[model samples]
Target: MNCESIRNQFSSYLDGELASEQSRRVERHLSDCQGCHAQWLELQQLDARLQGLAVPQDLESRIVAAVGAETDAEQQAQPAPPPRGYRKQVVAAVIGLAAMIGLLAVWLRPNMPPVDVPPPLAAVVVRSIGNVQVRAPDAEGWSDVDGPHHALPRGSRIKTPQRGGCEVETATDAQLRLDANTEMVVHGSSHMQVLRGQVWCQAAPQQPLTLGTRPPADTAAVPDVFVCPAASEMQVRVDQHQAAEVGTEPVRKAWQLPLLALPGSDQGELSSLVETLLANVGHSKMQFMNADQIRALGPRGAIPLLMYVREPSSSQQPAVRRQAMQLAAEVADDTALTMLDELLADPDPQIRRLAEATVERLSVGSAR
Candidate 1:
């Protein structure tokens, strides 16, 4: 690749997000090109300086206060508080000042009111058939996605074992499927970096999916993004550090499309690292007392599980939901049960089996 192209990936390379071969290529280019190498060294120094600094404990609170406080313009719009010692000023002066203050406030008040906007949503991992895992942002290790708990942080990674693959859904209902032996780093809900293997994507009937691909060498200029019009599907696979697209195929809905549009909704809440351990029972299923035998488990065990089940934010991982369902029924936790009932309407056989088994188990226990 030329210097210009190589430089385009410097940010990703510095973040260690490049594929092995791609990373090696960049290293080679840096070694051969003095200009690029100098730039790279400078980048490394900047990163080191940034990393060595510690954030103040009140940094966040200070930032929030600064952002939420009235700006200088807003303060000025209130008319200087009548100068404090203006009691001697004539009544006409006071009347004129009041009239001018009202005019200024009306003219300088913001054109738009402050609207409370929620944070951006991300794609969630909804289906997993084999060994899948997700690595949280800035985390030191990868966690096996044994079951459930597939909500993704915007900058996190998801990978699958040789026989494993998973699906992700966006709030817009776009869905993407990762093939086995693939690693993908999601860039928000719409964009992703496919380091290896392939992905299938199907856009929602109304959502036009813009699939971003790695640009090609200078000699072969490729379009940066492919627009899969509403209701279309596409495939993207990595080859030689570039995304090679398979021509759009509108049919063949076997359910694994990484870049196509699919239906989605907001699911799952973000948790602190320690709190994550308690919430992620699906990642450590063995530690969970058998769902069928939770009768001996105390409120300590049951409350977190029930709380997780009832939380508005939850991924649609079948195992986690089913286990929570069992707990809800066992304790007669109507709210948790009601939440599960509403979420379980998909009737996908895998989910149906879980729902059916829960009902059957509950019924048989009552009969005894």
Candidate 2:
């Protein structure tokens, strides 16, 4: 085989996918061509860098159960096999979606760092109902909760809008159930802060739980503090040996704060960075890391970039474009209604549906 043609088949060759005759020809060329051999070696070295892959098993079951729950019936397909390229796309998306927690926690497999490190699990997301979103500690925007979410890192914030509610079991064995219009921040194993809305706390059975409330709730039920969130915040503290204190005073760092200025008073650098990440959104390594960066840029600055990326004119991959649209929904507000309204005409039915939903949500939020 000629150098050009043989190089095109390198991935297939590495995957042991070449036909016998073609594989022999490619092998002959690699042995004789010094440059080709070096290139192949580089590819192998890069492949070896990815070692010790860890996929969270709890995360996997949650995704499976969530999908199983959503589908009302099972239909067997006996159609022709899909194109070879189709499977590649599906695998890429499924594996990389974690980096994309812009699908999950802590953000990578997106809640996690690009490197391998055991993230401290702060709590388990036991239940998620209706529309729910979570923001990783220091994340700039909410990530739509798809499927069952597990292993929330400390300091992550979960919110249930007027329509949704969620439940979590902390490492301390305490259980907290949030009602609609509630937002909560988990402060490690034993501490929790409910910024707003009503929440019922079930202290660890083993601990002498002390529960406190901002205003006051009936703590008559031992180990159970039914927080009547009437103008007061709730605190659930479960100590191994001490009484749990639950009370509401002033809320520190409530979810809504002044929006951050774009990396100081300058917009020039921020604009340039946005363009850079957009152009490289499909790069092998960059695609997995870009979601967090885009979210951190804030919705206002990303409004134009988001429109460009999700537009049919852009060159992003299908997965990347889908991620962008999902992100648009996360940060969407009344200010984004115009762009989302325009998206209503998108040729992709999925995008159109998402845009319609986002618009409705923005309208509702704006009214409030």
Local distance difference test, per candidate?
Answer: 0.58, 0.57
For residues 68-100, write the lDDT of model 1, one tens digit per residue. Answer: 353444557875554534333433354445455
Best candidate per TM-score, number?
1
Best by lDDT: 1
Question: How many clashing residue pairs, candidate 1?
Answer: 21
Error of 2 at 177 (Å): 0.4
lDDT of 2 by residue, 79-121 (tens): 4555657545655565567644532343335454475444356
